[model samples]
Target chain A: MNALSTTVGPPAMSRRGPVSTGPNIPSLVGSEPQQRGMGIARSRLVFVVILFCAAFFVMAARTVELSLKKAEPMQVTKQHVTVPPVQFTRADILDRNGEVLATNLGTSSLYAYPARIRDPEEAARKLVSVLPNLSEGHLIQKLSASKGYIRLQQRLSPRQKWAVNALGIPAFEFAPDEERIYPHGRLAVHALGAVNYKNEGISGAERYFERRLSDAASTNQALRLSIDSRVQYALADELESAMRVFQAIGAAGVVMDVNTGEVIAMVSLPDFDPNTTRGVSGNQRFNRVTQGVYELGSVFKTFTLAAALDDGVVDFSDGYDASLPMKVGGYTIRDDHPKGRYLTVPEIYAYSSNIGTARMALDLGTEQQQRYLSDFGLLRAPDIELVEVGAPLFPARWRKTSTVTISYGHGISVSPLALVTGIASMVNGGRLLPATLIRNSEGWRQGKRVIAPDTSRKIRQLMRMVVTKGTGGRADAVGYRVGGKTGTAEKASNGGYDRKALISSFVGVYPMDDPQYVVFALLDEPKGTKATYGFSSGGWVAAPVVKNVILRTAPLLGVAPKTEDEGLYKNVALRIEE
Target chain B: MRKIVTISAAIAAIMSGVMVLLLNIAVQEQASLNRTLAKQIHDDREAIRILSAEWNYLTTPRTLEDRSGQFLALMPLRAKQIVNTPATIPLRPRGQDVDTKGASSVVLSSADKPRKVKKNQRKGTAL
Candidate 1:
């Protein structure tokens, strides 16, 4: 404790006194302390030099220790840490570009302890001051009751919560709660789905991905779907506008990546807001693209021709007579606008000759038609990540009659999602990819081979022919090399077809020279319009919708435009005149 | 003389021990500061989460389209009008003097364009 134990004396004292009490060094050396000022100065100088050398050695040793030691990351000790609970109950749903589609927004639920309230009248009065919606007389009765805990309000806005806090009612308690909110409001309602009072996913994607959203590992990171909000909005806007113009009962549209089968956008009209599901009609809640199967009239012809061409039953050069109504058993098939003579394969398609397509189907045979439809994924509901998918309705027996009617899209019904998925297969180099709503961040999906690559090229050429000089001329977007078909299927009634109620649809692929996207638009029971000259066909109603969507989304998709004069597809020569 | 040598070395040893103690105190202070900084980072991430939801709300396609439709008379972009890069459009003829008129017109055409886009445009990769 005395001068003997000091490691280093204070700076002022070390100048004149011994720096350390290390076993009396001077006494051990047997030296006398009889030196003058210069002797003391020289000794001090020696002390300074040794001090610097000692510091240098210490720093060198520490450096060696650091370099030699295995580099360990500095760990913020988590062994005994009491972590806070997860703030939100459900994981957020984002679009492909990371735009939040659905999220659990936080709110405070106001509750009160009836036993703790000193003045029932004053407490109820104070509570009503911030929350004017609560009945004052009712609150007075509930607050005065002997019940232990009473709920005053289920949800309160941040401003209301702050104001209620300012009231400073000791009996009141605020429980942190969250509600599923879709701030985009009806934008992708059919895709994201809705949640119930307990925040349980009830329908749509919300119901489908319940476990993933609640899973602790994935609750922090958002669930990203393959929907692009911009593309989705453009598609929906065009379809809705067409539906309004045509006075259709309902409308549905779908857009997908041809090669990947990633559904970029899907819209079903009369869609309800996911935020508020109460008082919504079943029709409004229905997802027509995935959940409502309808006989999509002439769009089915593309499949028949693809099947016939791929199976070598017919080439692009071959065709059938459309002058007479071809009869398959008892059913007679006639073209909507007959050419009154022999129709070429391209003419049959461009003019939408049902007889020609039915004849092609007969050549392909019933078994081959069924196999092709199955391979195209049109026989079953699409394999999308939603629980609301509708099973396709088809004839149980594959007869010649069934084949002929189905050839022109009459004998069976399939969801719009299935039709678009099938069209994607026909043009995506003949690979039939299972449609997906989830984003495949990994890589391109490997699809099953449905048709030969050469067949796909020919189909693309034929579809371009339809847009350039056929029924789908309305959908021929300039510089896009648009190619598609128009379908106007009379709705099936009690043992007969109702010609008045038509399911007019157009399924198309753009930049046909190198197809990337397939767009399908359908209007249900569209009454003939004055502008359309009382014609409610797919070409009049849905083809223009598809064209608008392509024009709007092409810039967003960054597809470089080519001048119309650019003769890029000279290899595929199609003679429209013949 | 040996007594003085012994004393100087001992003094150096004692001084280094005191310096080591001072260094230990400084490290302790720094570690506590790091803990505070880490807490701030955690809180900031949470804030960003809430803010992102609000940001998306204010800028959803429907909202942005409606607001822009009201405020700006800008027409929708067309495929022909878009050029992938500036290099694709030559600034001017190679050796020609800077055409002030042409340069100003180019700037005027693209006037009021956003200087920066913080929004993540989801240009999805091919499957």
Candidate 2:
């Protein structure tokens, strides 16, 4: 490069007429130096322009390629930008007052990748040190397995998770998970039901509202139930105490709003806690209030008498002969404790006489009896927001014996919920509203009237008489005007009645003149007690429960109490036969 | 002139490179901060869920009832004890005006004793 520069430098100097060969251009003529400088500047400019053109050529070619590629669909950039996956949560269950009943608890589940673990024994030992419940030998064996992934534990509490994290064992990872928790324990287990490990609702309102509960958009909002937690506690406490006192195998009870058919509280005892449903017996999980079908005995007499009056077969002023056991077909119907004389219709109902009820049913015939029972929804499973409801058992081909026995609640079996709802229809101005578990401002459907308003009024009078003068006197909450019927049906077993094992139940309505609420309680196979004088009748075993329930819950339901001396229900009180 | 052009071009190249580096660093920082914020929000939501569940478990009816039984002296209100209206409250007798400043001053005689609750008091009665 130096030799070429020397040759070019002299030629350029000669062309510009330079006299001296000095290295410095300042010592030469001004015109000669200026011409030589111009030539050098032009050459440098051409070199820069060439370099710039090369860069432009490359940029332009790239631009052309990009533009041409736009026309080809296969050239589309399918960049798979991954995002963190969001998990769906189950909605919370709340009482009417916005108190939490059931909720989805977030937890961290631990899993192990055996193939990624450095030392199975060391990892298992460290893990067991933090989690004492985990078996060291089992964990070691599990961690040493060749499986790519293995679940080590599930539903770890936050503290437990922290302890496990502190261990810092390799190959152990925590996966976020959830568990369904029933906060109330066994208080409303039968109502809230339970969820499986997969977070799917298995029974009760949980199963009924599964779709709405798991919806991602609505999961945060709590699903409000009509149940008032305080009233539910009261009902459950009274029922459980009664069950204990009576030595019953199990018990069921319900408190329903007569006007709306909203079940304020429903309890089926011998219930298992939803939190630990493992190894729970079938009997413990049975929701007797809505699932078990029993012939509710004299509770059905309310309907028989109402049907008679509604069909114009009898009047409140009419009298029926209870002088002897009335024979119907091959069966003879007799009162539990007969009056031994003719009694008025109100008297017959107050005493809950099977003879009077069967006679009335004979007068109405089987078709009319079937129609009334069907209208009361006694012939079908109750349409409620629960999956455990039982379809009623009744004779498909109605006959004379069927009518007679059904009148006294022996020839048919229905759930306790069905009986309570039927009584609600008879007393709530005759409107048979569909019972519901959801709270509604407008209550349930008004429904068609099963009986005339006048008949309902007369039936209410008869019901109040039962509390005032007869078997249900034990259920008379002082100022609440507690009114209902005592049903002591011998449970049918082995194709025959088990007389010793009775289902003692009472369907009590408060403030009979107003009829705002209906409370029904039933005890299965309650043994005779010393306090009960060795009698396990409905009045002895179940009526006191109703009395206490009304006393405790009426105030919670906002039913005003009248002084007994106020003569509020005096007009409806029945005169007892001496 | 060539020297002036060459110096200006070098300065421009260095400036562009520094600007690109600074912008790239800023964008990367923003993205990292966004990821951190998203994780924080997710954790906060999970914490809230856990706390609410714990609150529910602590306030269950059974637990509350147990607490009440141990600590509270209040009993469930009875139907007869509930007064629907102010008029239903028996007025204080005239002779008991010694300390009428407070409604609690009145003392009841044996005759004013509460009537027994027949429904709850009766035991061993024939059914």
Q: Write the per-residue lDDT of candidate 1 for residues A61-108, one digit (tens) a residue.
A: 999999999999877674223334446778999999888999887788
Chain B alone, candidate 1, TM-score of: 0.53
Per-candidate Cα RMSD to the true structure, in Å, reads 11.2, 11.0
Runs with alpha carbons beyond 4 Å of true place in candidate 1? A1-87, A118-122, A125-129, A132-141, A564-575, B1-36, B83-104, B107-127
Over the full model, what C-alpha lDDT does candidate 2 score relative to the true structure? 0.84
User: What are the clashing pairs of model 2?
Assistant: none
Best by lDDT: 2
Per-candidate TM vs. native? 0.79, 0.78
Q: How big an interface RMSD has model 1? A: 3.3
Score chain A of each prediction against the true chain A by TM-score and list the results: 0.84, 0.84
lDDT, candidate 2, B1-127, per-residue tens? 8667778978988998999999999978977887777777777776676677678778876687789889999776666567677766665432232443335633533243235325565432222
Candidate 2: list runs displaced more than 4 Å: A1-88, A564-578, B1-48, B88-127
Worst 10 residues of 2 chain A by lDDT: A76-85
